[model samples]
Target chain A: MRDFRVLLWLRWRQFSDGLVYWMRVLGYNPKSSGFFEKLYPLYLLIISSFWVFAMWGFGHDNAVNIGSNIHPTSLADLLKAIPPAVLILQVFVIIVALRSTPLKLSFADMSYIAGSPIARSVPVLLGFLRQVIFRLVIIAGFFSLFALVLTRPLAQNIDLSASVRAMLACIPLVVLTWALGWLLGILRLVYPGVSRWNYLWVLPLLILLAATYLPAPFLWPGQALVLLIYGIAPWWVYPFLALLAIGLVVAFVWFGNRINMILAVDESILHARVAALGLLAFRQPNLLLRIRLQSAAAGRKPFLSLPKVYGFQTLATRAALSYLRHPFMLIFSAVWGGVMAQAAVWIISNELPVQLWIGWLLVVGIAPPVGLLHVFRIDVEERFLRQFLLVDGLQLLMADVILPLIATIAGAMVVWLAQGFEPEITSIGALFIPILAILLALCGAVALTNKRVLQTRILATGITFGIIMVVGVNFSPIIAFVAAVLSIMTLGGMVSQNA
Target chain B: MADKSQEDGPLLKVADVSFKYGSLNALSNITLEASPGQLIALVGRNGAGKSTLLKCIAGWTQATSGEVHILGQSIKQNERFVREHVVLVPDTPPFYDELTAFEHLQFNAQVHGWQDWEDEAEELLRKYGLHANRNAFPFAFSRGMRYKLALCMALLIEPKILLLDEPLGPLDPVSADDLWEELNGHRNDGMTILLSSHQLPQEAHPDRYVIMEQGEIIAQGSPDGLRKSLHIEGPLSLDALLRSAIKSRKAVKADA
Candidate 1:
């Protein structure tokens, strides 16, 4: 216990130091920024105020109409609907919170902590504590504001006694959500390489959908138990649920502890798996094949085969592969394609005007460039710029910009085919405009900004799209031609400056 | 005592060190310890574990091992001990691209828990004749200036045990001479410095030397001892002697 405390202190110190360093880099002196930093609490207050307002807006009309149609429903129905909604919201919060954990547990930071004289268990425990505290604060703040708005409608529907019972019932569920989030957060830290588990968002969504659609009696015991307790013995029921919540919290902590222990012991296994995937890049066969094909066709000597790429090229290629190989990439393309096809069908079936069809087509054409911006954002967040800088910038640009463009175009073609668009030489020309737009955006992003790439890309896209929209509204071929020329010049200027 | 004399005991020991990629292992057997102040130069061609070993000792690659004990107590067990006792000057200076020589020193001072690093950094920069270009970004500075910056960072740390990998690769003659002078000053302070370099130091100067062929240590001892064992002449240069020794060792291995 003493060792753990000491370790925790050391970890805190390290975190504090790192935070200070980052702040310094960001040009925030502790002495100078002290007042400004304190204003963060004020910022939070403003955000909370806005959130409260939004929630109140949702409930405003409902609150007034609450007593007008007081169909005194059974307690069971109310209990059933509320728990699932709360559970779903709790899960949504948990997934977003857990998503950043793996990134935070980077090797460099871990090495620094591990090398310190602090006890091993302490750092791990402290890490878990930090995440839990952060999650708790966020969850509590969000729900507190949400509960404020909900209180009015809830009060009108139920008597004070029932309101108290429902709040008490919610206490355990909130505790359980916090505990589950903490557990998942630790898992994210311990096994950062395992991306499959990041989709813990699906769990909450499933629980939410199930709660809404599935019959209350069949789905959860908590709701039914809460109702029974409220009816038969409210006092005993609150205590029972409280105890259950405590038990769940205990179980969650124990599970985290067990997993942490296993991770420590099997850290090598995890390391090996991560190394094989991250370092080797061969674990991703499609990417490996592409690299091989590119090398063979380009008639360049293969750098290192599986493991020899090293440094930035390795990281960039891996990023590209991960983005390309994701199942969602295909799914998103298909969905968008379906949307376009549906629009086409609506135009034909409803005998909509040709102008409306042309408008829809233009919107769909603009979609690919807009979509490319999102991909660029993902790349930036993945720290592709750091990796990109390591290689010959042009080669990196080709690998990152050109290859992904090809992949996205292929995806677009699939969407086009799914929409029953017949192949034509001129149909291929439709791709040129979007591709040019994406390239111009990429070049501008690289040249203009020193900030994080994602921020730069998003900013660039916004500006480009804004201009395109303004010009595109006139639907003049001359304006379009001028926009293309300007975009090309901007891209050329950026490339030359970088060169 | 006999065990200490035996080559089997680790030259270095690392403990509880974990490093990662987005989630991976750039390095992790890390338990290593060299003999007391031996001028052991880690050589493993490229990425043959030389840099990683140096990094672990320097506290760059924290021990994914068990514990890094210099003499007995683990360095990882004590933050202050590791900080003041061990120092690492990387092959490339981990300088902020934006910061000039003076600013980097200021940052280093902060990292080392120095209350006033700016003055100290300025003093060091002036002493090293880097004051002229102190305001220049590391990118604007020549390779030699960058090397000087790394040396300056190491000096600010004031470590007893200095770990340098390819320290001399980037420096010019004057800069190299300045480094040797600094190293000599540290030596006078009883500092134990372990540096890895492709270019061998003057044999006449070193207290001892260790040559690594693969991952394994091939030869280790006083420069003269190595010279005698390898059957080299008196006043032989360490670089040529090493080449000859490596050649002979390879021949013997081939015969075996």
Candidate 2:
């Protein structure tokens, strides 16, 4: 208990220091601060409140529209989708937990706590609670908004009480899932030999696959929650979920008592290194990605070998081999493409609401696929390595991105074709997929060739959008394609010249 | 006269080069010349513009004024050509995370259009005590090992002028001696080398020492010449030389 308190105090100091650093970066000086400087925290709070209020408005309107008019039949589909979606989220949590336990320790924690005579479970329990609570806040907030959508007070005449009941039910589900995840992850730490089980993370996915065949018990929790949300569930369902949550928490604490601090430290080295970067991690995401990649590939043999080739082909082959070794990057590219395509299908099918279009644009701009320029960024940034390669910037860019682009296109096409648009629209959408993917890649590459990557990326995105909106509206699709091609050449020329 | 000078002139030349970071003058009128087969030690305290000057000469950075010439060609104008002939191995060099130690050398050799480079790569790795870790990623290696790998990569290129910034900082004493010996061998082969260091191995000797302070050259000459001209009263060492240099500069400033 004392150890836990000490650790908490340490965490508090670190958090305060981080807050002070951010305040200073925002031009606040505590010593010479005026009323405005003191009010900065309040300003941040008000901004956050506004964002939440906006999300609430958007969510309420969309929920009412879907329930009352737009895709009224899909409301049943949405209800059915919620359970599987929750199950998928749980499965994802468990899979990550199995691979790398949720326990994250800073360098200070490792130095001060790990080697101490304090009970091993103190740090473990504290870490578990910290993660669980952090995750709970995000999960609860998300499900609360979702609960409002499911209630549909304006459309279904469902009272606010049902929404409260639904939100309450989701809390237990999230807690229980994370508790189970922590229990399983802590057992691996308790028995260090389990950490040696190659590809143990795959077990959760395998169970998910088996659940497709036998969905009775696997999806029972989600189904119960859905019933609870509709206010039709048996009274005992709530008690059952609460009991399960309690049991998982007890199991996690029991296993956590036996945790090997040595193994925990070993597991946490990568996290500690990244956490050490602090704000720098947010500023240079590629640095974070590189650290994670190096950690993932630390002791593993690469699955693919670079072919014996010469010239630009060698670079392309090396890039392809790199992607093959880290197959998740390719999977993520495909997933990104599919999700963006699905969103586009939704917007278009609904007659292209301006709000939806704006949302989609924001998502694409803020979160371009991290892998699109992963290899190219390294190629350009590492001057030591860049000096040896003889290719021009455009050639290097194309070589590095060819495989990921193909995967993205493949994924987008599958989603676009599966949506069953009109034949003409499908063909036209197919044409747009490659162009958009190429443009996104070009935007990222152009940003990477500059020192200010974030600013350049946002600027490039704006210019690209402006050009497409102007040229795409005034001209035919073919002419738009020509304009996009010209834009690509120009951007490619800039990258080459700068590179 | 121009043709004759081009044929036999210094292989590396920095004529009145200066650099600035915004308003801070990092390198001011830093003139240096290095002929083939000569090794020069750029001795300085931290932030004495040693690394900055090396960067300028290697075209990794553009000088604010004047020119860095290699083989009678301007580095700024003929950067690509200059790059092919010059390699700068920084203190903490970065490597591809996806590449192993040996692969780094192999990639460098292949990209440079070398044929049958495996033996040479293996020999370099063995020489650097990294043969056992050849299959390991460079990121996982210790700082000393990473520096050694960077050195191996630079040596494999066989550049006409090699610039090493604080090369001994990440090396052990034995490894440092081995590095000096290896550098001596390269210098004997007519590969002009300029290395920056605050301290050098006691037994190590360079053909010339260029001492700097506050981004300006305070004194430069052969080690013996510097020792004599600086009026050092004790055993000549980097500390002694640096102290004397600063004292002389202060005396000259006071006199003016």
Candidate 3:
């Protein structure tokens, strides 16, 4: 316990120092800018205030037009519908929860805590506590906000008090899922035998889904369990979930006692960095790949093979090989490009101002979360400017674009084929491809040209390009291609002989 | 008049070069020149602009003011001309983790348009005793090994001027000696090597020692000349001479 307090105090001090650093950077680092840097904090404040007000207005609007009769023919059907949906939601939530496991200590913590005489269990307990706290906050905040926005629609059809209480029940349900997720993750570390048991969380969910249509006597217990909690006993779920959370914490600590500290540390050190960098991954996409390399096994000694091309084409081939050799790297790029298409399509299809909030968040969140436009990071890495300064800036820039271009175009082609059912000259999805090319060009240009705050620049450029692509999707292909060519010329201006 | 632009002039020259990070001058009006075959050791305390000066001359950084001329042409306007002849090995060498040790050298050789650099690459690895793990990623290698790999890459490029920033810090004593011997060989071949470090290597005497304090070169000379300049009454090691020079300048500043 004393060791835990020591660790907590250390974390608090680290957080406080980081706060001061950010305060200096965000407020105005005089060393970074002249007078323009000082105005940023103010600009951020004004924009944030308007955003808050806009969300509240959006919530009010959602509250007004909700569930205006004709959804459910009977109340029992609605009650029963809740259990299965919640069960499936738990599955998705758990998948996201187990992204990575780590002891979550920095180098300083390793020095202090590992050297301390306190029991090994303390660090493990602290790790779990920190993980659980952060995990629950993320899950609860996202889901509860979703529930709050959605409950307004439910209130129109049902009694306001009962509906609010039922909707509020999701918090505890999410809490239960958090507990189960970490308990399973911890059990895997302490007792590898129990790792296989984690796959069973989906069993009851599957049974519940099957029992909805089939008359299976064996699946009734699972179905009844979900229904009783989600539908019948919404009031008492909070205490039950609190008890589950407490029980899980005890299990994690007990499991922590038996786990090897050295093994955990080895497993966790790089992951801790990856987790920390994941927070700012949007702001610094280059950091994501850096950590990925740091954690990756150093035995990757594959010989590089390049084409016999005589000029800048050799660099293009090597850049392409960088994508091909790193396993699943090209796939990740294609997936992010597809996500951009989906988000852009959403923005084009949706008319409501409130829906645009979701669209904007989707667009901004995609950069770090989906790692959209990470192909640009290859140039930022490898001290590339020093490595190939003799190469013409345009060709170097062109080489960097090849992988991102191929991946994004393939992705855009996927979306275009899907939306090609009633393809008109104006409504064709291929029209958006040129606009995506321009956005990608913007991505490469900023990464190659700028040396600081690349995350902010990329985010701003990506979001702006996303908006332009959405608008372009509505225009003729010729106009979009023209915009793309103009943007490509804009790319030339962003580069210099020294760039 | 002999054409200075024809490859017979001073190998490296920084004329009124200055670099500023925001309002702080990292390198302030620093001027230094090195002829071919000169091994110049830049000795200074940390944050003394040694690395920044090297960077400006290497064309890795653009100076805030003034020009760095390599082979009698401004590197600012002629990056290709300078970059072709010079390379800066930063303190921490960067590796593309995706590439193995041999691959890194191969990539550099191929990119630099060297059609057959395999024998040179193999010889450098064997010389560094890294031939055994030539196929491995350098991230797991020791600091000494990483430094050797970086050195190997630079050597293969065979730049006329090699700018090494704090090259001796990560190297072991024996490796350091071996590096100096190789550098000695390079000097014989008329390649200028500029090394920056906070301390001097043991039993290794550079042809010229440039001492910098607070972003400006306070003194530049041979060991005997530095001893005389600082008014050291007797023979002193390079460390003692640098210390005395720093103290003498501080006292002069304080008195003024």
Candidate 4:
């Protein structure tokens, strides 16, 4: 217990160090920092207050009315959806290779924690508990807000006790989900064979997704859980969920104390590095990406030899080969396309208010191209390789654009087929994805060949235009087209001058 | 000042190329040239801008107020010409983490549109002791292995001019010797080399030595010429040449 206290004290110091690291990353040394730079976070906080107020006001006004006897369908329907919601989250956890629970220590942390005479398992178990406790606190903050929103409605309609029960249910629900992820991490240590098959876990998720379309009886446990949340299940259901949550946490902590955590620590370093990259990606993205690629685990080399595709075709083919071998680019591109497809489905269903519909459309519309932030980035640092026979760097840039766009279109095609060949929205999405991708690719290439301090600024402007264009698309197609035309004009001017 | 520029156009020419990184002079008034078949060693300590000089020649970085001409044409104006004819293997290999060593060779060959370089590549892989791990990605390979793979890729191109920044910095003694032999083989076949190193190898027999200090070429000549001119007593090693060059330059700078 004393050792655990020491570890927490160490973690606090590391957390402060992390803050300094981020500040340094954002091109600031605290000693040389300017006055305005010091005020930036406070300025942001002031601006964000308006947004916070708006959201809080809406949540308070609307959520409090849920128990009003005026509407039976919406609240009841929401209650029934709770179990499926949890299942979706669990599926997401599995998809990301159970990385939702980030139990990791940096190399620096290892020197302190591992060097201790305290049993190796004590530090690991304590670390896990510390992570879970922090996450629980954040989760509780969100729940308190939700209770503020929903408590009145349930108090008016169902009863005050039901609202209390519902809020209390959030604790075990969160604990179970996180504990399940931790247990998987422990299992990975115990059974490498089973860990290798983790990718296959996605198949059952797709099946569960399909099953949701069927009758309520088929959902079984999930259906029962939903009823329990709505306070309509057998009385034993509450205790059942509580026992399940507590059991998983106990098992994880107990099992953690037995196994050697060196392997887990080693694996966690990779995850931790990737997570760090994700944070610094917004600043010096290219440099961060280069570092990530350089450090990346070079898996089993693919058997495919370089194809004899000549000219710009060769560049495109090279990218295709990379996608095939690496798979992450293809996977993310497909996910972006899937998101677009789902948005299209929802839009076509005509369920949302006009404002919400347009907002969702813009978000999903801009996603695919943004997902391909590094599409034009050749993983190699040797500039000479590209220009050996390169007529123009733009031709090589075009090649990168084509692969991701094709993947996006292919993803949209899959979802289209899955939607039983609905052509109206999906057809437009397929076309839009490529057009936006080309514009983004053009931006990336222009940034590369046309070296300037304005590289980041131009990208920022393009993103601003994209955000505007998304809203414009719903209001007037003419406006959206004008935005595209203006973007192309800007790109042409930069390229013609720089090239 | 002694005129180091060639009378007739040299194979590769750098004239008064100076670079400043925020007032830190990385390279200052660096003038040198290489004939078609010479093995020139660019010897300097770290921060001496040997890599920067190579980068300027290779067109990886631009010099502040000077131009590099290869075969009597500005490299900036004829990038494709330079890319086809010249290769610069940077200190750290900028390898694609996803591509295997063999794939990197295959990729370079295809870019040059060459179809029959496989045998040459295989020979290179064997010579550098990477034949067994040719299919492995360079990311997992040791520092020397990565360097070898980069060297193999550059050699497969068969460039008229080759620039190696810290050529033997990452390699083991055996690999270094193997590479030196391969480099000599290229030199005999009439390829030019400009390599930088902290200190010349004990076994190295460079045709000419260019000693640099604080971003300027302090002295340049054949190994024997440098020893004779500087009045060195040792067996004319590169280390002896460098020491004499550095001492004379410091005394001259002090006088100035």
Candidate 5:
């Protein structure tokens, strides 16, 4: 037990040290005696409070009445109510685990640890334990809050024992979900392309659960017998259910370990291939020039000049070339276009009123700009713009803002066309409003914030999305215009402040 | 002469090694060997496959054909062995963007399980005149400082073989002198060093120099041996000798 405690402590220290190292690399000094540093703990406390409060508020009614008076007549209802909460809790745990483990077992950190004389198993075990502990704490906190808040209200109507049993039944389910999430997160390290496909697993699991119609008597004999005596289910089902749950947990752990091993091997090979390609491509002059140009454009420069092309053509050409090469842009365009096409057909066939198309327009309109932001931000982060500043003898401060504006305009045109020219030529003019707004926003962000425009834009967009969802606002042209203006102003203010 | 099997083992051997970038061959049908504790200078013009050869030996770039054996063990069969035994100080050292000299040393110590090496790292940093800037990021440093930091990292690893590519490119005279002193120390410790540089210093005294052109080694011998064979002045610089060898090779080919 002492040795175990020591190992845990050592692992925690290593994880913390690694996090601190990376934070320092990113120019963050959390321990510094600055105003922001002092307030950081308070800020974290506030965020955690917000998360807890929001989750509890959303979950309270369902938690208290889990299996009491509102007896689930169909398996679909039971599955829907149970899986959502479980999935949400699972996602929370997975996010915590994913965010923590990278710090503990990053390539650089692992390189150091692997060289040590200590047993290889020690670091691996410790890294896994740290991730598990972080995940468990988040899950336990949410569960405990739900249990405390909902128990009294739920017990008033339903047999408290049955309710408690049902909640207890969910423990293994949560663990299984967590294990699956961890496996997927680990897989991402090896096959980054597959990481986004994680959502596909949940639908199948939910479907399977919905199909299950086993009654308590068969599924949990000991518990059913006990519940029957106490007017819950029957107490006979408890022991059987408990054993099944134990088996599930064991299976989960085994699968999780298998995933870890598979991913580790895959990551090792993938990294080697990337390194080899990097070496091979390093000496190619044309390739190097392209890389240099694209890197510069991404760095948020307003203009780049080749030996041939002068002025805006230089910057525009570079931007166009970068967009052409970017993989995510292709993926986003294909997916967006496909989804929109399907929706347009579905809407026309259903005759679901003209207003429904407005929602589609809004979604389609927002997709391109958001996608362009991602591509633009990659360049920013790579600091490719800095290289252009040296070569082109032109200030790229405006170029960075202009490139995104152009992409946003192009995206808006696609969205406009997808709507089949709604409101005819008049709507075309209105489309310019949003494009201009987005352009202004992007420009303000890049010009004012300089380095942090991308991050701020994302945060602002998320906040806007949350507000729109919570308020249940109807899609309107006027609302779109207002949003465009506000976004532009907000981003512009941020950029100006930075400048 | 190459048939001596039971004699002293070659420090490095690359047999039938081929490397390709897509369809373009970077190295092909290449074979080379070096004796234990020998300092071999690999001289080639840019794009002459010198860097690729060094990378293959260092286990950074795997050969597409055949094998590279360091101390008689195939690098493919035991990469960890190569990693532990050989270190590559690339022309542009891969640095942690954010780590300071002190932090990097601490990381190396923890990674290598050298519990008491913090003191050693500190002493070395002070010895190398990097003590004052120990806490600064490598990005904040000059090119020369970055080179020193890389050199310091390489020194901390203490590998049996060091493969350097233009290691002296960014160094000032004083740092170069310090580096030469350190290299002398490593030589005394029987560490085999393989390096390529366009500008060879007078003091390096590399045991042999391999002059390559158009992706093939055109001449190989001790610096003195090459000079004597070619009837040149005593103690000729590697760069001058290489230039002379290339000219002679071209003349011979033209005559043929």
Candidate 6:
């Protein structure tokens, strides 16, 4: 008990010190800050509160509108989809937990706490709480609003009862899912021998696949939660879920008592490196990606080699070979394209408000596929490696991005074809995918080559897309294509000059 | 080799070069020259602009003013052409995370349009004691091994002027000696070498020493010439040279 208290105090001190450092970075030193500087955080809080309330108000109004206009059959279909979506969400959580061993310790914790005679359950419990707290709050809040929308169709007045019930149901589901994930991860960490089992992370997918053949029991948890949200489940359901969650937590803690400190420290090294980066990790995700890739490839042999080729072809083959070795990057590129295309179709087909278009544009601009300029960024950034490549900047960029661009286009085309649009529209949309992919790649390469900040890059991408949309809507697709091609040429020249 | 008539001229020259990081002068009016078959030791304290000078000479960084010339041709006007003749291996060299050690050399050779480079690449790995790890990624290598591999890559190109920044810092003593011997071989072949170091191997000797302090060259000469000019009483070493040069500069400042 004494050790636990001390560990908790250490954790608190670390958190406070980090907060102080971040505040100082923002010109608010805790030691000698002026009154105005001290009030900066309060002012930020008030502004953020206003923003959150405004977003909630807008979302609630949209939900009400949707509830009233949506067909009764469609509501039933949505309710049906809810259970499967929840199950899939839990599966994703499990897969992610397995992929990175849920028990993470920062370097400080590994050095100061891991080697000490403290009970292992303390850090395990603390880590679980830290990981789940923010996620629990955010997920419950979103589900509460969703419950309001579902209840609006049946109730004449705004009732907080169903939303409260939904929030309550969501709390247990999140805890229970995370607890299960933690249990599996703790088991893996407790016995070092289990880690040698190749593709252990794939076990979750196998379980999910097996669940498809036994849906009734596999989906009961999700269905029970939905039933609770509707205020129709028996009184025992929520309590059962709460107890199950507690039970899993206890099991994981019990398993944690036997964790191998060496393996745990080894697994946490990657996390520690990224956590040490602080805000830079968020600002420069490529650094995070590089760290993750290095961790993944640490002890593994590469699957492919550069072909015996010459000149630009050598660069192209090397990029292709890298993609082959790490096919997950290509998979992510395809998924990003598919998801964005589906969202774009949803907006257009439903004739939704224009603000959603802005939202889509923001996502497209800010979160261009991670693989879009992955290799190209390294090429331009590493002066040592860059000197070896005799090619110009534009050629290098194009060579590195060709495979990912093709994958993205293929993904978008598949989504478009699945949507079953008219022949002419399908042809036009298909034609637009390659152009948009190329334009996106060029914008990223240009910003990176010019050493622009991320915000500036996002704004540039947004403005370019806006111009294209305006021109295409007001004029002709052909003219828009010409303008886009011209912009590509200009951006290409900039990249080349900078390169 | 590209210009036979220019063989008589200095191989590498930095004429009145200056560099600034924002308002801080990193290198000010740093002028130096290296003739063929010369090995120059760039001795300086930390942050004394040795690395910065090497970068400027390599054309990896453009100086604020003045010129870096290779074989009498301005690097600014002929950067790509000049780069083919000059290479700078930074202190902490970076390599591709996806590439094996040997693949780095292969990529370098292929990009330069070289044919039948396998034997040379293998020899370099063996010479550097990296042959066992040729199939391993450089990210997995120790710091000293990574530096050695980087040196091998630079040597594979056989540039006319080679600039090494703190090359001895990451090397073991024996490896350092081996490096000096190999550098001696290159120097014999007319490859001008400029390396920044606080200390040299015990058995190794450079043709000249260019000592710098605070971004400015304070003293530069052969061992005996520097000893005679500075009126030093003891056998010359980098530490003594630096101290005497700093004292003389301070004295001059006080007099002014």
- Prediction 5 TM-score vs. true: 0.37
Q: Write candidate 5's Cα lDDT for A102-128 as tens digits.
A: 213444434544344443344444554
Q: Write the per-residue lDDT of candidate 4 for residues A344-424, one digit (tens) a residue.
A: 554454343444444554454333344353544553234644434444555555565566767776775677567654576
Worst 10 residues of 4 chain A by lDDT: A62-71
Which residue runs does candidate 3 get wrong by more than 4 Å? A1-130, A148-167, A192-262, A273-285, A298-314, A324-328, A354-378, A381-385, A425-427, A451-477, A496-498, B1-4, B202-205, B221-236, B240-256
**Where does model 4 sit among the CAPRI classes?**
acceptable
User: Which tens-of-lDDT digit does each residue in B64-179 have in candidate 1?
Assistant: 54566654455555443555556676666544332345655654454344665566678779867798876555545667677787778778767657787787798876667767
Listed per model, the TM-scores of chain A against the true chain A are 0.42, 0.91, 0.68, 0.70, 0.42, 0.92
* Model 4: residues with Cα > 4 Å off, grouped in runs: A1-85, A94-105, A108-121, A133-170, A191-243, A260-263, A272-303, A308-313, A340-375, A379-391, A412-431, A447-499, B1-8
Model 1 chain B TM at 0.75
| Chain A accuracy of model 2 expressed as TM-score | 0.91
Which stretches of model 6 miss by more than 4 angstroms?
A1-6, A33-80, A145-165, A211-213, A224-236, B1-9, B254-256
Top lDDT model:
6
Query: With candidate 1 superimposed using the best TM-score fit, by how many Å does residue A274's alpha carbon deviate from the native?
Result: 14
For model 2, what is the error of residue B110's alpha carbon versus the real structure, in angstroms, after optimal superposition?
0.8
Extract clashing residue pairs from model 2: none
DockQ of 5: 0.01
- How many clashes show up per model? 22, 0, 2, 1, 37, 0
- Cα deviation of A304, candidate 3, in Å: 7.8
Residue-by-residue lDDT tens digits, candidate 1, A213-236? 774633453453345324454556
Q: Best-fitting candidate, measured by DockQ?
A: 6
Enumerate residue pairs that collide in model 3: A66-A153, A283-A455
Error of 3 at B163 (Å): 0.7
> Candidate 5, which segments miss by more than 4 Å at Cα?
A1-499, B1-8
Question: Alpha carbon lDDT of residue B53, candidate 2?
Answer: 96
Per-prediction TM-score: 0.36, 0.91, 0.76, 0.79, 0.37, 0.92
Residue A272: error of model 4 in Å?
A: 5.6
